[model samples]
Structure formats: structure tokens, C-alpha cells
Target: MRSSPDPALSASSNAMLARARTTFDIEAAAVLGLKQRIGASFVQAVQKILEVRGRVVVMGMGKSGHVGRKIAATLASTGTPAMFVHPAEASHGDLGMIKPVDLVLAISNSGEVDELTVILPVVKRQGVPLIAITGRVDSTLAHHADIVLDSGVEKEACPLNLAPTASTTAQMAMGDALAVALLDARGFGTEDFARSHPGGALGRKLLTHVGDVMRSGDAVPRVVSGASFSELMREMSSKGLGATAVVDREGRAIGIFTDGDLRRQIETGADLRALTAADVMHVGPRTLRADALAAEAAELMEQHRITSVLVIDAAGVLIGALSINDLMRAKVI
Candidate 1:
């Protein structure tokens, strides 16, 4: 059976995508337009959350609730304590979740859910600070809130002009803007995010330093300057690091001797049986700080076209040695 085309719309092959693209562009533009809406109310909202010693309690119904959950998560991750509560569920014993020290952030496009309206009185009577995110500034929730954040959209992306498409995206983007602004104000840094994501790849990349994974001290292949080539080979073979550091009398790294050095020396007909360590060691090999990120070490190795780098402290003393394989095994790559 053949399906008939709709009589009300164009039968063009690109019509569906064209319409969707237009809708997406409009929604994206609306999100960008929200910048003009920031005012003292935004500051008040942040101040309310900052002053509260307890968690920020967010309540909403329908699409707004979904975005509220994400906003709450972002807030918690960025140094602000927050949680989402369903307004309909609050009518049940779930209202016990509310406490005096908390701030309430309510989300509802119309700001007029019957359940939310019912709870608004209790929220006001209990002295819980209320921050409202709604399309209508004069609506019931916004009128009662200590601070009102308007997430107004000219129209929804829904072709039917009813579904919460552009409206919901605007709400979510506004929530993110607020959360990020507050995060910056609170001085949340990369370390704070790393602490929250301690078990993930980002944690390993940022928190794991060269010292944590590098072959240290004796395990690092090393040969004193002027040592015989045989002794250098023995150090490299014994340590299995494929490379040995040639240190000056002060114990600072002066050069490095690697497997490549041996191959080059042999190609040049250099007497490996009689050459000293300094005769073959390459000077000014790559060196990284002990505190440098393992990820950065991996980048340097790739950029320098080498498989290893020496870890040195501020004093220029060789403290550890790292290889590409070690970082790969640790999954820092």
C-alpha cells in the first residue's frame, strides 16, 4: 500500500528538515536572547541560595521538573547544595523533605499548577525563601517568590504551538547560566570538579601527577657522566626502562641515553665496547616537572616525537622517569 501525502503541507523532500531546522534555530536564538533578562533578581536568587545553610529545594511539574533535576545536579556539583522535589508529590508526606534552613526554587511555565499553588502558602508561611522560574512575571508563583527568574519564550518550537519545545530549552539554558554564574562566583576550580569525579577518566588526567606514576629514584635508569658504555647498557637493561639518564656531578640531568642512541652509535661505527656514557648520550632531552599532569606528559611525548620523558623538580634533579607505555597502562591517554 502507498501512503498518501498530507494535503495541508508541501510535499518537498526537504520540507520536514527545513521546518525542524527553522525551529531549532529559533530555539537557539531564544536561549541567546536570555542574556538581556538578567537583573537584580538574578543576584537575589543567588544570594538566597548562598545564605541558606541547607540544600536548595527545587519544585516543579511537567517539563520544568525534568530541567529542574539537571539544574539541581549542576548546583550540587558546583559547590552549591541543591535537590529537586515534585510539587504533586509534595502534597503527600513528601513535604517532610522541606526544612527551615532551605531555599525553594520553583519552576512552572505558567506559574499556576494547582498543587504548586497549594504548596506556595505553606512555603510562604514556613518562611522558606522562594525563587520562581516562570514565563509570567505577575503569575501566582512569581508574585509570591522572593526573587523571580523569567524564562519567557516568544513561542514554542512545537508546530502545534502547544508542546514545551523552545520553552523547555530556554528554561534549561537559563538554569545552566545561573548555575555556572554561581559556580564562578564561588571560585569553583578544576580541582573541585575533579573531587566530584574522583573515579572517572577526568580525575585520573588532572589528579594523577608524574610522581604518582613515574619510575622513581633507583627504578629510573641512570648512569653517572663519563661512565663506560657497557655500564650504561647494563643500567638500561637492568631497569627495563629502555632509557638511562646521564647526570652531572651535581646529580642534575645533563643528557639521556636511549635504545636509539645505541642504534645510532652502531650505525656510525662508534666503538660501543669502548665509548663512554657521555660519548653517546643525547643532550637536552625532554624533561617535565614532578607536579605536571600525566596527560600533559603524554602530549609532550607525542609532540617531541619521543616515547619517554624525565621528571625533574625545580632544582633540575632527576626524580623520576616516565614512558608512554606507563601512561597508556594507567589510561591517562
Candidate 2:
């Protein structure tokens, strides 16, 4: 149609795309440049959060609400207890969620959501801490908050420059910075993360110990030093574990034999009928402490290039066996 419009004539149509790209690059650079903008007010905000006896109540309108939700989730997952409240909903009975000792985190591009502004007096009257994220340092919300985090952006991604795209991105990045800062300040550790996410895969990997997954005592597929090959086979088959531990007279693990060992012995033409547990067992197969973390055991198995491990207690007495399957079942994989 119309001579199929020349490909070179796509300039005006592509001008908006260039502007959008430039806007995004500038926004990303602005986020990276935030390190220089942070000051003592950031520390004061953290102190306000730490001292608050109640939950962090985050309120925003429209697009700001979306960012607030993410910020609340990040804060909650990292040790600080926070929840999002819609400014509109807060006016209607939902305000009850805001306790007197709570701290309010209000987010707005203009720093003037009518709903949030209306509730400002209430927050202040309760003696609650108020922190604001806004594009203008002297905006109403900023003036009201005890600490104001500037999230200004030079331009918008919209071609008309009317949308709040880059400004919102800058705000979201600042919220993440605050969350991580508080996480470090609170001394949030892996153990604390595990406690928060006990049912998740990472939690099981970090907190499930060798003792938690190991088959213990009689189920360890162990035999004494003098047990014959026939006795070893019976013990291995009954226990259903791939490997059997070899122990001394004192009932401590001395060595181990597995399906691999059986294959090697068969290849070597060793007489299975005459061999004893001590004669054929591979000495000192990979062993683990009962108290070792399941992730540590997994790492050890990977490091030593093995599948199964023997679990021994503090006294070095054979207590149990842990197989790769046990780790998978515990979600340590």
C-alpha cells in the first residue's frame, strides 16, 4: 500500500522508542547514583523502624501501592515485620490495622495522595513514626514525615513526559536499598532466614541436619568385624540401604561396603563365600557428623564425589546412615 512505505521512513515512528530507551537508561543510572544521595536521614529511618513496637504500615495510592506491596514483602522476608495498607482502605475501618506504636511508610510520586494526606494528622496524633518517599524534597508528605527519602527522576519514560514511570522505578529501588540496609543492621542471618521460611526448600536445605535425615541405630546396615560375606549380604538386603558400615568390637564405624564395592570384588574374582565384612569393606568411606547441616552434608558428598554417608555422633560411634534419596525427600536438593 502506498508503495509499501520505505523502511527508512520509520524515523518518526521510532523516535518514541529512542526516547523510551533513553528514559530507562537514565532511570537505571539514577538508581545506581542513589548511593551518593543517602545521608543521616536513612539511618534515622532505620532507627525509627527498629524502635517501633508495632508493624510497619505502608500506604500508597494506585501505582505507589504496587511498589509499597513489594517493599512490604521485602521488609517482612528480611526480618522486619511489615504489611501494606491501601490509603483508600485505611480511611474505611481498615485503619484499625495501624496500631498506636506502628510506624507509617507513605509512598507517593507527587508526595500528595489526597487519601494519605487526610490520614497524616491521625498518624501524627498517635505519636507514630512517619517516613516518606517522594519526588520533591519539600512536598507536603516530605514535610510531614520525620524522614524523607528523595526518589526524584529527571524525566519520564512516557513520550508526553506525563507518566510516572522513571520516578516510580527510582522509588522502588530506594525502597529495596532501605530494606537491605535494615536487614544488615538487624544482623539477619541464614538461621534467621531459615526460621522465617522453614517450609521452603532453602530452609530445609540449611536447617535439616544429618541426624534429621539419617537412618539410625539398627537401620544403619552395620556388621561387626568378623561377619562373613553371607551375613553382610543379609544385613545389607534387610536394611535396604545401598551400603553397610563395618564396625569394630566397640561398635564404632570402622569402614563401609557398597554396591560399587560388591561390583569391584566380583570383578576381582574375590570369593564372596569366604570373605568377611572386614576383608572386603572399603576402609573409612565418607562419614558425616550427626549435627552437620544437611546442606553441608550435600556439599561434602559433592566434594568427595559420593552418594551416601555414614552419620556418627560426637563420640564417633556409628549412629546412622544418610543416602542421597533422604536428602531429596527432605528437599535439600
Candidate 3:
């Protein structure tokens, strides 16, 4: 039997849901507000990073430092070289990591964080280009920066308005905006991104080729055209490819025989024992070049509604075979 809900619990849940919705509203508005403030300073920051011969040195403190680290990673992965350095650590020997050729991107909500501000004069003395993302345009960090990006928010989503809620959201949005602008200006593409993230899904899809995933040599299931139906079945079962290729004397694929063809022949009541591979196989089978992308092989399989295809060379000689199962194992599909 079901029990009735407690009124006290119900009221508390309602209040919590309302607060959650309000937080989303506040954070969303903070991010949206950044769209209007993007102008000259933003463009200048992008241009400067593009012209730099060295990496972007990102620095911040507290919550802003967390956001800065993410920003640096995004920048690095997207083609712009970047790394994060903690502000407090910078005062104690870490500042040496910032070279004159490297540009500094400093993040602070109030722009007056002492750990961050204390390094401003030393950074300026070294003649390193500095870009500031902060709420206060009139603060000391902004005054010393070569470019200032306004990440100011109306208020925090925190009930006391003391925590870094909406403010941090605004800072991250600004960082993403800068990364995106710089990526476009540098003409960075998917292949470049994949190279930086080879362990990721897009990397596997773009960098993997048919040769990398196809079964080659003895592993491929194949039989001479004159071979008996029993020989074809044996090759198919041993290789576990669900199909077998019929090849000629020169080792070129002449036809293909699949489980489907066997079922069709049985349905027709044909004398299976009297058949040769050439007599039962389907001619004009689908084929792919070994150098072609695995993604292309997948598309070909999908287009023709087949579970496997033959891999051939420039001379159309059969060298390998690929199947849907192979693509699955490689995570190309």
C-alpha cells in the first residue's frame, strides 16, 4: 500500500526547487549579459594572442583560478598554446615561468585580489603583455593590463550574494569566447583538434583508416572461385566474418557469398551439395581501398545495407576484408 506525502517534506522540496530555478535564471542572465560587452578589447586580445610566438600564461586565484585552468586547457586543445600558473605561487619563484614572449591572462572577480595584483608590477616590469578578465574596469589589474575584458555580473546567485556563482559563470563564458575567437582567427580545424586529443572519440574517427582496422592476409575469409560450397562454409566459419570472398587466380575478388545467400538458396530448394563458390556467390560485391578512412567504410556498409565488405589494392587485388564487427571493436562506429 502507498503512504501519503508529509506536508513538511513537501514544502521543503518546493522551496529547494524554487531556489534551483532562480540560480539558473541568474547564471543564464550573467552569461547573456557578456554578449553586449564584446568589442574592441575582445578583438585586441584575440589579435595579440594570434601574434604571440609563445604560449599563453594564464593566472588567477581561488574560484577564478579554477576557471582559469579550464580556460587554459581549452585554449591549448584548440590550437593556441596555453598553461595555467597560480597567482600566490607566482610570487614565490613560479613567476619565472612567464617569459616576455608569453602573454599573461589574469582572472579575478573584484580585480583587487592581492595575490594576483601583487604580481602586476613585476609582470609589467618584464614587459609581458597582460589581458585582464575582471568585474571592475577601474581596478588596479585593469589599469596595468594591456587589454581588459569586462566579465562583470549584476549579482551572485548565492542567497547572501557572497559566493562566486554568476560571477564565475561570466568569467568562464568570457574565456570560452576568447578561445573560440582565437581558434577561428588561427584557422584551426577538426583534424588539428583531433591531433591534440587522440584518446577521444573524434580522434579515433578521423585518424583511423581502413588498413588500421581491416583483417589482412590469412585472417581474411576467402576461397578460390572453383572451391566447393563446403570449402566456402569452412572458411567463413573459421574466420567468423559472416561472409567469404571468392577470389580468382590473380587474387582479385570476383564475388562474395554470405549467410543471406545461403538462406536464399535453401528457400529456393536448390541442390546445395552440387554448388561451387563461383556458382553460389553474388558478383559485383562492394569493395574499399585500404587507404580509405574507416568512416568511409562504415558509410559504405550503411548505404548498401551490408555487414561486411572486401578491401582491395590499386590493382583491385584482394588484400584484406572488413566487417561491421571490426568497426565496432575499433570504436569507429
Which candidate number has the best lDDT?
3
Best-to-worst lDDT order = 3, 1, 2
List residue ranges in candidate 2 displaced over 4 A. Answer: 1-20
Q: List the candidates' TM-scores in order.
A: 0.85, 0.90, 0.94
User: Candidate 2 residues 1-333, lDDT tens each?
Assistant: 012334675877566556656776878777866677889988888888988888898888888889999999989999999999999888898888888889999999898879989988888887888999888888889989999988887777666878778878888998998888889999999888888899998789778888888898677899997999999989988998888999898878889999888999999886799989999998877888988998888888889877788987677789889988888888898
lDDT by residue for model 3 (214-293), tens = 99989999999999988999999999999999999999998999989989999999888889999999998999999998
Q: List where candidate 1 sits over 4 angstroms from the true fold.
A: 1-12, 199-202, 247-252, 312-317
Alpha-carbon lDDT, every model: 0.88, 0.86, 0.94
* Model number with the top TM-score: 3
lDDT, model 1: 0.88
Query: lDDT tens string, model 1, 82-201?
Result: 999898899887788999898999998888888898999898888999998898898999889999998988888888889998888988988888788889888999888888777888
Clashes of 1: 0
What local lDDT score does residue 322 receive in model 3, on the 0 to 100 scale? Answer: 97
Let me know the TM-score candidate 1 reaches against the reference structure.
0.85
